[model samples]
Target: MWLYITIGLVALLIGIAIGFFIARKYMENYLKNNPPINEQMLKVMMTQMGQKPSQKKINQMMQQINKLQKK
Candidate 1:
Protein backbone atom coordinates (compact mmCIF):
# COMPACT_ATOMS: atom_id res chain seq x y z
CA MET A 1 0.00 0.00 0.00
CA TRP A 2 2.79 2.48 0.85
CA LEU A 3 4.58 1.72 -2.40
CA TYR A 4 1.42 2.30 -4.42
CA ILE A 5 0.79 5.61 -2.71
CA THR A 6 4.34 6.83 -3.33
CA ILE A 7 4.15 5.85 -6.97
CA GLY A 8 0.82 7.63 -7.39
CA LEU A 9 2.19 10.83 -5.88
CA VAL A 10 5.23 10.76 -8.12
CA ALA A 11 3.12 10.17 -11.20
CA LEU A 12 0.85 13.05 -10.31
CA LEU A 13 3.82 15.38 -9.87
CA ILE A 14 5.33 14.36 -13.19
CA GLY A 15 2.05 14.87 -15.00
CA ILE A 16 1.69 18.35 -13.53
CA ALA A 17 5.20 19.32 -14.58
CA ILE A 18 4.68 18.08 -18.12
CA GLY A 19 1.38 19.90 -18.42
CA PHE A 20 2.98 23.16 -17.27
CA PHE A 21 5.73 22.90 -19.85
CA ILE A 22 3.33 22.10 -22.66
CA ALA A 23 1.11 25.04 -21.78
CA ARG A 24 4.12 27.39 -21.63
CA LYS A 25 5.35 26.26 -25.01
CA TYR A 26 1.93 26.67 -26.56
CA MET A 27 1.64 30.22 -25.27
CA GLU A 28 5.07 31.11 -26.59
CA ASN A 29 4.18 29.85 -30.05
CA TYR A 30 0.80 31.55 -29.98
CA LEU A 31 2.39 34.90 -29.11
CA LYS A 32 5.01 34.46 -31.78
CA ASN A 33 2.35 33.83 -34.41
CA ASN A 34 -0.04 36.53 -33.24
CA PRO A 35 1.81 39.19 -31.37
CA PRO A 36 0.00 41.84 -29.31
CA ILE A 37 -0.91 45.05 -31.11
CA ASN A 38 1.29 48.10 -30.66
CA GLU A 39 1.19 51.81 -31.45
CA GLN A 40 2.94 51.39 -34.80
CA MET A 41 0.51 48.76 -35.94
CA LEU A 42 -2.38 50.89 -34.88
CA LYS A 43 -1.00 53.83 -36.78
CA VAL A 44 -0.72 51.78 -39.93
CA MET A 45 -4.27 50.52 -39.54
CA MET A 46 -5.64 54.03 -39.05
CA THR A 47 -3.71 55.25 -42.06
CA GLN A 48 -5.13 52.46 -44.17
CA MET A 49 -8.56 53.55 -43.04
CA GLY A 50 -7.71 57.03 -44.43
CA GLN A 51 -7.46 58.69 -41.04
CA LYS A 52 -4.39 60.65 -40.09
CA PRO A 53 -3.22 59.07 -36.87
CA SER A 54 -2.16 61.71 -34.42
CA GLN A 55 -0.29 60.82 -31.28
CA LYS A 56 -3.13 62.00 -29.06
CA LYS A 57 -5.63 59.88 -30.96
CA ILE A 58 -3.38 56.87 -30.75
CA ASN A 59 -3.02 57.29 -26.99
CA GLN A 60 -6.77 57.62 -26.56
CA MET A 61 -7.44 54.55 -28.67
CA MET A 62 -4.85 52.60 -26.74
CA GLN A 63 -6.48 53.62 -23.46
CA GLN A 64 -9.87 52.58 -24.73
CA ILE A 65 -8.54 49.28 -25.93
CA ASN A 66 -6.93 48.69 -22.54
CA LYS A 67 -10.20 49.50 -20.79
CA LEU A 68 -12.10 47.05 -22.94
CA GLN A 69 -9.55 44.35 -22.34
CA LYS A 70 -9.68 44.95 -18.59
CA LYS A 71 -13.37 44.25 -18.66
Candidate 2:
Protein backbone atom coordinates (compact mmCIF):
# COMPACT_ATOMS: atom_id res chain seq x y z
CA MET A 1 0.00 0.00 0.00
CA TRP A 2 2.78 2.43 0.88
CA LEU A 3 4.66 1.63 -2.35
CA TYR A 4 1.52 2.20 -4.37
CA ILE A 5 0.99 5.58 -2.76
CA THR A 6 4.57 6.63 -3.48
CA ILE A 7 4.25 5.61 -7.12
CA GLY A 8 1.00 7.48 -7.41
CA LEU A 9 2.54 10.67 -5.99
CA VAL A 10 5.50 10.44 -8.36
CA ALA A 11 3.23 9.94 -11.33
CA LEU A 12 1.09 12.92 -10.32
CA LEU A 13 4.13 15.16 -9.97
CA ILE A 14 5.49 14.07 -13.35
CA GLY A 15 2.14 14.70 -14.99
CA ILE A 16 1.94 18.17 -13.48
CA ALA A 17 5.46 19.02 -14.63
CA ILE A 18 4.73 17.87 -18.17
CA GLY A 19 1.52 19.91 -18.28
CA PHE A 20 3.27 23.05 -17.09
CA PHE A 21 6.11 22.58 -19.57
CA ILE A 22 3.74 22.18 -22.50
CA ALA A 23 1.63 25.17 -21.45
CA ARG A 24 4.65 27.42 -21.05
CA LYS A 25 5.99 26.50 -24.47
CA TYR A 26 2.61 27.04 -26.11
CA MET A 27 2.12 30.44 -24.47
CA GLU A 28 5.62 31.59 -25.39
CA ASN A 29 5.00 30.82 -29.06
CA TYR A 30 1.50 32.23 -28.98
CA LEU A 31 2.67 35.55 -27.50
CA LYS A 32 5.55 35.85 -29.93
CA ASN A 33 3.13 35.85 -32.87
CA ASN A 34 0.33 37.84 -31.25
CA PRO A 35 0.14 41.53 -30.44
CA PRO A 36 -0.41 42.05 -26.74
CA ILE A 37 -4.04 42.92 -26.17
CA ASN A 38 -3.51 44.45 -22.73
CA GLU A 39 -1.17 47.16 -24.03
CA GLN A 40 -3.74 48.22 -26.62
CA MET A 41 -6.46 48.24 -23.98
CA LEU A 42 -4.30 50.41 -21.72
CA LYS A 43 -3.72 52.92 -24.50
CA VAL A 44 -7.43 53.14 -25.12
CA MET A 45 -8.12 53.68 -21.43
CA MET A 46 -5.50 56.40 -21.31
CA THR A 47 -7.08 58.17 -24.26
CA GLN A 48 -10.47 57.93 -22.60
CA MET A 49 -8.91 59.48 -19.51
CA GLY A 50 -7.94 62.50 -21.68
CA GLN A 51 -4.20 62.44 -21.66
CA LYS A 52 -2.54 64.72 -24.22
CA PRO A 53 -0.48 62.39 -26.37
CA SER A 54 1.81 63.32 -29.28
CA GLN A 55 0.46 63.21 -32.85
CA LYS A 56 2.14 60.02 -33.98
CA LYS A 57 1.52 58.12 -30.77
CA ILE A 58 -2.06 59.37 -30.71
CA ASN A 59 -2.71 58.14 -34.23
CA GLN A 60 -1.19 54.73 -33.51
CA MET A 61 -3.04 54.53 -30.24
CA MET A 62 -6.33 55.50 -31.83
CA GLN A 63 -5.91 52.84 -34.50
CA GLN A 64 -5.36 50.13 -31.93
CA ILE A 65 -8.24 51.41 -29.84
CA ASN A 66 -10.57 51.41 -32.80
CA LYS A 67 -9.51 47.93 -33.81
CA LEU A 68 -10.18 46.55 -30.34
CA GLN A 69 -13.43 48.43 -29.89
CA LYS A 70 -14.71 47.07 -33.18
CA LYS A 71 -14.26 43.54 -31.89
Candidate 3:
Protein backbone atom coordinates (compact mmCIF):
# COMPACT_ATOMS: atom_id res chain seq x y z
CA MET A 1 0.00 0.00 0.00
CA TRP A 2 2.79 2.43 0.94
CA LEU A 3 4.67 1.62 -2.30
CA TYR A 4 1.62 2.30 -4.42
CA ILE A 5 1.01 5.63 -2.65
CA THR A 6 4.63 6.68 -3.16
CA ILE A 7 4.51 5.73 -6.86
CA GLY A 8 1.28 7.66 -7.39
CA LEU A 9 2.71 10.75 -5.72
CA VAL A 10 5.87 10.57 -7.82
CA ALA A 11 3.88 10.21 -11.03
CA LEU A 12 1.70 13.17 -10.09
CA LEU A 13 4.72 15.34 -9.40
CA ILE A 14 6.31 14.41 -12.71
CA GLY A 15 3.13 15.14 -14.60
CA ILE A 16 2.86 18.56 -12.97
CA ALA A 17 6.44 19.45 -13.91
CA ILE A 18 5.96 18.40 -17.53
CA GLY A 19 2.67 20.31 -17.83
CA PHE A 20 4.23 23.50 -16.48
CA PHE A 21 7.06 23.36 -19.03
CA ILE A 22 4.70 22.62 -21.91
CA ALA A 23 2.38 25.49 -21.04
CA ARG A 24 5.31 27.88 -20.66
CA LYS A 25 6.69 26.91 -24.08
CA TYR A 26 3.33 27.34 -25.77
CA MET A 27 2.84 30.82 -24.30
CA GLU A 28 6.36 31.89 -25.29
CA ASN A 29 5.74 30.84 -28.90
CA TYR A 30 2.32 32.50 -28.97
CA LEU A 31 3.68 35.76 -27.60
CA LYS A 32 6.60 35.74 -30.01
CA ASN A 33 4.36 35.33 -33.02
CA ASN A 34 1.83 37.81 -31.66
CA PRO A 35 3.51 40.40 -29.55
CA PRO A 36 1.43 42.10 -26.84
CA ILE A 37 1.99 45.48 -28.53
CA ASN A 38 2.68 46.49 -32.11
CA GLU A 39 3.68 49.72 -33.89
CA GLN A 40 0.07 50.64 -34.68
CA MET A 41 -0.97 50.18 -31.07
CA LEU A 42 1.98 52.20 -29.92
CA LYS A 43 1.18 54.97 -32.36
CA VAL A 44 -2.42 55.09 -31.18
CA MET A 45 -1.30 55.26 -27.58
CA MET A 46 1.10 58.10 -28.35
CA THR A 47 -1.59 59.98 -30.26
CA GLN A 48 -4.01 59.57 -27.37
CA MET A 49 -1.37 61.08 -25.14
CA GLY A 50 -1.07 64.07 -27.50
CA GLN A 51 2.29 63.10 -29.04
CA LYS A 52 2.83 62.79 -32.75
CA PRO A 53 4.61 59.48 -33.16
CA SER A 54 7.19 59.47 -35.89
CA GLN A 55 8.46 56.29 -37.56
CA LYS A 56 11.89 56.72 -36.00
CA LYS A 57 10.33 57.28 -32.59
CA ILE A 58 8.18 54.23 -32.94
CA ASN A 59 11.15 52.13 -33.99
CA GLN A 60 13.15 53.34 -31.02
CA MET A 61 10.31 52.61 -28.64
CA MET A 62 9.97 49.12 -30.09
CA GLN A 63 13.66 48.48 -29.60
CA GLN A 64 13.41 49.60 -26.00
CA ILE A 65 10.44 47.34 -25.42
CA ASN A 66 12.23 44.36 -26.96
CA LYS A 67 15.29 45.06 -24.83
CA LEU A 68 13.18 45.14 -21.68
CA GLN A 69 11.47 41.90 -22.64
CA LYS A 70 14.79 40.19 -23.24
CA LYS A 71 15.84 41.13 -19.72
Candidate 4:
Protein backbone atom coordinates (compact mmCIF):
# COMPACT_ATOMS: atom_id res chain seq x y z
CA MET A 1 0.00 0.00 0.00
CA TRP A 2 2.67 2.49 1.04
CA LEU A 3 4.90 1.41 -1.86
CA TYR A 4 2.10 1.92 -4.33
CA ILE A 5 1.46 5.42 -3.02
CA THR A 6 5.14 6.31 -3.34
CA ILE A 7 5.29 5.00 -6.89
CA GLY A 8 2.19 6.91 -7.88
CA LEU A 9 3.61 10.15 -6.48
CA VAL A 10 6.87 9.63 -8.34
CA ALA A 11 5.02 8.98 -11.59
CA LEU A 12 2.93 12.10 -11.16
CA LEU A 13 6.05 14.23 -10.57
CA ILE A 14 7.81 12.80 -13.62
CA GLY A 15 4.77 13.47 -15.79
CA ILE A 16 4.64 17.09 -14.61
CA ALA A 17 8.33 17.61 -15.33
CA ILE A 18 8.02 16.20 -18.80
CA GLY A 19 5.06 18.44 -19.55
CA PHE A 20 6.94 21.56 -18.40
CA PHE A 21 10.02 20.67 -20.44
CA ILE A 22 8.03 20.13 -23.65
CA ALA A 23 6.02 23.37 -23.17
CA ARG A 24 9.18 25.42 -22.70
CA LYS A 25 10.80 23.94 -25.81
CA TYR A 26 7.69 24.61 -27.90
CA MET A 27 7.42 28.25 -26.73
CA GLU A 28 11.10 28.93 -27.35
CA ASN A 29 10.89 27.64 -30.91
CA TYR A 30 7.69 29.63 -31.55
CA LEU A 31 9.17 32.90 -30.35
CA LYS A 32 12.47 32.49 -32.21
CA ASN A 33 10.83 33.05 -35.62
CA ASN A 34 8.50 35.84 -34.47
CA PRO A 35 9.28 39.54 -34.65
CA PRO A 36 9.19 41.75 -31.59
CA ILE A 37 6.76 44.65 -31.26
CA ASN A 38 6.97 47.69 -33.59
CA GLU A 39 6.03 51.27 -32.86
CA GLN A 40 2.55 51.16 -34.43
CA MET A 41 1.75 47.93 -32.69
CA LEU A 42 2.95 49.32 -29.44
CA LYS A 43 0.81 52.42 -29.87
CA VAL A 44 -2.23 50.33 -30.66
CA MET A 45 -1.68 48.19 -27.61
CA MET A 46 -1.24 51.24 -25.46
CA THR A 47 -4.46 52.71 -26.82
CA GLN A 48 -6.24 49.51 -25.97
CA MET A 49 -4.81 49.84 -22.50
CA GLY A 50 -6.36 53.38 -22.29
CA GLN A 51 -3.35 55.45 -23.41
CA LYS A 52 -3.30 56.99 -26.87
CA PRO A 53 -0.37 58.21 -28.92
CA SER A 54 -0.45 61.37 -31.03
CA GLN A 55 0.07 61.09 -34.79
CA LYS A 56 3.02 63.51 -34.85
CA LYS A 57 4.73 61.57 -32.10
CA ILE A 58 4.20 58.27 -33.86
CA ASN A 59 5.59 59.74 -37.12
CA GLN A 60 8.65 61.12 -35.36
CA MET A 61 9.32 57.79 -33.73
CA MET A 62 8.90 55.96 -37.03
CA GLN A 63 11.28 58.35 -38.75
CA GLN A 64 13.87 57.68 -36.08
CA ILE A 65 13.38 53.95 -36.49
CA ASN A 66 13.79 54.25 -40.30
CA LYS A 67 16.99 56.21 -39.83
CA LEU A 68 18.28 53.53 -37.50
CA GLN A 69 17.40 50.82 -40.02
CA LYS A 70 19.29 52.65 -42.73
CA LYS A 71 22.42 52.58 -40.65
> Best by lDDT, which number?
3
After superposition, the stretches of candidate 4 with alpha carbons farther than 4 Å from their true spots are 38-71
Give stretches of model 3 more than 4 Å off.
none
**Candidate 4 clashes between residue pairs 3 or more apart in a chain or in different chains:** none
Summing lDDT over every window of 10 consecutive residues in candidate 4, give the lowest-scoring window. Answer: 28-37
The 0-to-1 C-alpha lDDT of every candidate, in the order given, reads: 0.89, 0.76, 0.96, 0.78
Q: Report the C-alpha lDDT of model 2 over 1-71, residue by residue, as the tens digit.
A: 99999999999999999999999999877865765655556667678889854567767875775577557
- Pairs that clash in candidate 3: none
Give the per-residue lDDT of model 3 (tens digit) for 1-71.
99999999999999999999999999988988888999999999999999999999999999999998777
**Alpha carbon deviation, residue 9, candidate 3 (Å):** 0.4
* Candidate 4 local lDDT, residue 68: 70
Worst 10 residues of 1 by lDDT: 28-37
Residue 26 miss distance in model 1 (angstroms): 0.4
The candidate, 1 or 3, that scores higher on lDDT is 3
- lDDT tens readout by residue for model 4, 10-51: 999999999999999898676555535477686997699787
- The clash count for each model shown is 0, 0, 0, 0
Name the lDDT of candidate 1.
Answer: 0.89
Best prediction by TM-score: 3
Tell me each candidate's TM-score: 0.56, 0.54, 0.93, 0.51
Better of 1 and 4 by TM-score: 1
* Alpha-carbon deviation at 68 in model 4, angstroms: 17
| Cα error, candidate 4, residue 50 (Å) | 16
